[model samples]
Target: MDTIPAILRAAAERYGDQPAYVEGARAVSFAELHDQVRELARRYVGHGLAAGEPVVVWGPNSIEWVIAALATTYAGGTLVPANSRYTGHEVADLVDRTGATVVMVADGFLGRSQVQELRAASDLPSVRAMGELSRLSLDHRGEERHVREVTIDEVEARADAVSPDDVADILFTSGTTGRPKGAMSAHRQSIGVARAWAELGGVSADDRYLVVNPFFHSFGYKIGILVGLLTGATLYPVATFDVDQTMQLIESERITLLPGAPTIYQSLLTAPGRAERDLSSLRLAVTGAAVVPVVLIERMRDELAIDHVVTAFGMTEAVVVTMCRDGDSAETVATTCGRAIPGMETRIDAPAGEAGELLVRGDYVMLGYLDDPAATAEAIDADGWLHTGDVGVLDDEGNLRITDRLKDMYISGGFNVYPAEVEQALMRMDGIQDVAVVGVPDERMGEVGKAYVVGTASADEVIAFARQRLANFKVPRLVETVEALPRNLSGKVLKNELRK
Candidate 1:
């Protein structure tokens, strides 16, 4: 099987001068990108990073980010991207789990530096700063090896030695059971995701890709970086998701593809000069992490003039189970998250209703969560059916519809209440823009619902509005109105933070 770097070699041979990645004022051609990966991989090998070992890639999206990722694959090392938002302790835990011998990071991001904080991890392999990495040379292998450069032959020959089943990345995902688990993705399967995305979307070398999702995320790291590489599509890296900045870049660059969450889109819509901006170059858009309401789809198609909107579903495991297929009706694209991708088995279990734990069985499933065998056993069964803790169902045509998340369900006065239901109910109310419902501890009922709302309505007004429709028990006892609720990089509600 062709390794990840081999895809670049193909692009280099076929479309050498074609621009492969673009960031700010720079654009890297396919041939140039490949050479950079080759040199960087050689540098990695020269530094003594072996095939069986791993390297921690921590930083936001940038041209260097993709270079480091591909370089790791070429050098035959597992790529473990530490969460950019991770605390020093959290990063330390990931480093320990991956057993990375080298950590590659970008320069001072957001003025709050990381190189120093990450170096403090006693368990760290070696800290390699971005500023130092730019100066990496392979000639001297051992002259202060915390971050040295290695050669093309050394990396490519090892790349030739690497196989499909080799662990490519250890992506840590927050599990429903409290602690996070590291999901191992293999080389071939990583390519499978890339291939599935390209085939589904018909992405080609002509496309200019804008990656707004965090580089650490599987959706962005694997599908965006790896898949974009496979297709020879030029990558436009966004370090942050500022609305005005994103809009300006889109209009200026004419970015052909955008892979981001709904919140990012929402933010961009609200940006000043947004309606006047010329975004005709954006041919395709992909959004996930949360359900995309029909209204959002209408807005994108009507307002943004995007031709196709792909709603994808999957975590680190299962790669991506289902997506709204090309030419699907707007309703399906907006509501149902389409059928299973090739080589993946998606089922609704006993009865396909409005909601259930979405079950999947596939080779793409993670080898197991890093050092969490008990949790691994609970998530992925012996027969290899990954029991996704998310609550969803298969619609009439078998399209997967995610209504609520299993763990996010709260018990209110002995009645189990899924927050999505309450949130959906709240979303229907006039002047109620966004809603996040979480269970607050209550002595009498064990737990009562509390809503953290964003937008116009005040606490009393929103509660009174809810009381008109919902039963007394279902109404939120304590409504805390806020400008915005905390969310993960993927735009997933940080329920844990709300609980805290």
Candidate 2:
């Protein structure tokens, strides 16, 4: 499909009665999805929201969140999804940055009212809770045509007014170093990546997708929701990724497809009474963000009975650059993020066999950072390559091994040390459940690796374990065991936080 609105229309016509999304006790069919989106779009129009305006959809996983997203697009507005886990200050920053005209937030999530939080943080207009909107929609029910007089043809016409090049979304990047910049993507680019990802994963109508990724992430909103629509797979949105609840959902829902970060599958593998649950229906799986243990991949297949376990690499600016294919070996799946998606091209800026910055250019590349011309120019050069601030190497077979973030690499004893490489080595260490390595200040070697692990291990023991497999320069000087590592909504460890 060309646009999200187009996908809605197409799915409504093709899979009219098939279930589209299921959240808790609520389930919506493809036809109902379209009707709800259309009705909501009319309400948005009735409220005087114009085309190309920005609307903030701030909430966790729910059918209403999905409807707000699609309705925003159908109303010819750009959807700016806010991370529900954000504090008031963070949410205020996004609302101010995006200049969102309307805020549709979940009421009292985590015992805090999102609308109250937004109001407390900033002076925003048209803030309405989801329950308020539901009541309003109910009050305006038979008067849908009379209130706005917007017919289905008129809604379609409004959706048709949105061009392929129009900015459909402004996804804020995880602000690890500085403030998060809004990465703007046109309808075509946003839809293109999801379509490619679905094809890469072999998503089919028969599949049932369990989306544990938060709705604010590109992985969840685009790949999870959009791919489900594209492939006609039933979507089950998990508001939280609790191991017990997630396993129960897979068993109860007969989930067939699940894709999340490495931590997700790792937790599922180690969950108590995991084998007692019936996860045999799981067929396709994808994980990334951290190094995937080879044994973990093997166990997922053998123990969980999952058929295809794929690994992929991408970012907010560009989605799905590389992905492991269906029949790739376990080592291949664990070690390398397989070749680029169909039409995307990736090249390392440094010498061959050496890790360097990875650059990508394709239809999937974003339009640019919203309202920041200088930053946009710095990110995407005149040659059209989007300079991904990541260090990686491409093997002869075209598979990509991401060493670390370019900013995460440090020079030690005149040699570069990538934390991801060191972290990968530490992941194989016995008694270590998860690991994050960061370069820390050192008096002699200029810099040294400091590892934060999620298991019981003494610093000396962990250093010895690393010394066995990694070079002297790569071995972590200090290993701190913690209950858990700090991570963002997408399951990426916050190394900056760790450095603190």
Best by TM-score: 2
Q: In model 2, what are the clashing residue pairs, if there are any? A: none
lDDT, residue 301, candidate 2? 90
> Candidate 2, residue 131: CA error in Å?
7.2
- Residue-level lDDT of model 1, residues 1-500, one tens digit each, is 55686776787888789888777778888889888888888777766778867777777788787788788888888888866655555566677766776677664665545666655655364433232333333323234645444455566789888888888888876544434578887888888877987889889988888888778888788778887768878888888777777778888888889877676666666668887888888889887666566888878888888888878887777668888876888888888888888778777665646466788987577787777788889988878889987778787777888876667866543334556656766787877878898988775455788999888888888888776545355678898878888988999999988988
Give the Å shift of residue 498 in candidate 1: 10
lDDT of 2 by residue, 1-500 (tens): 58889988898898999999988887899999999899888877766567988888777887888988899999899999877666565677777887776667676776766666666777754332122333324222222333345667777889988888889999986423335688999998888999999998889889999988878888899998889778899999887668999999999999999888766777788899997999999999998766667998999999989999999988888967899999999999999999999868999999989999999988888888888898889899999999988889999999999887756766554344667767766777778899888888774455678899898777888999776555466678887889999999999998889888
User: How well does each candidate superpose onto the true structure, as a TM-score?
Assistant: 0.79, 0.80
**Candidate 2 lDDT score at position 130:** 29
Once fitted onto the true fold, the runs of candidate 2 whose alpha carbons sit more than 4 angstroms away are 125-152, 175-177, 409-500
| Candidate 1 Cα errors over 4 Å, as ranges | 121-151, 352-354, 409-500
**Candidate 1 positional error at 137, Å:** 7.9
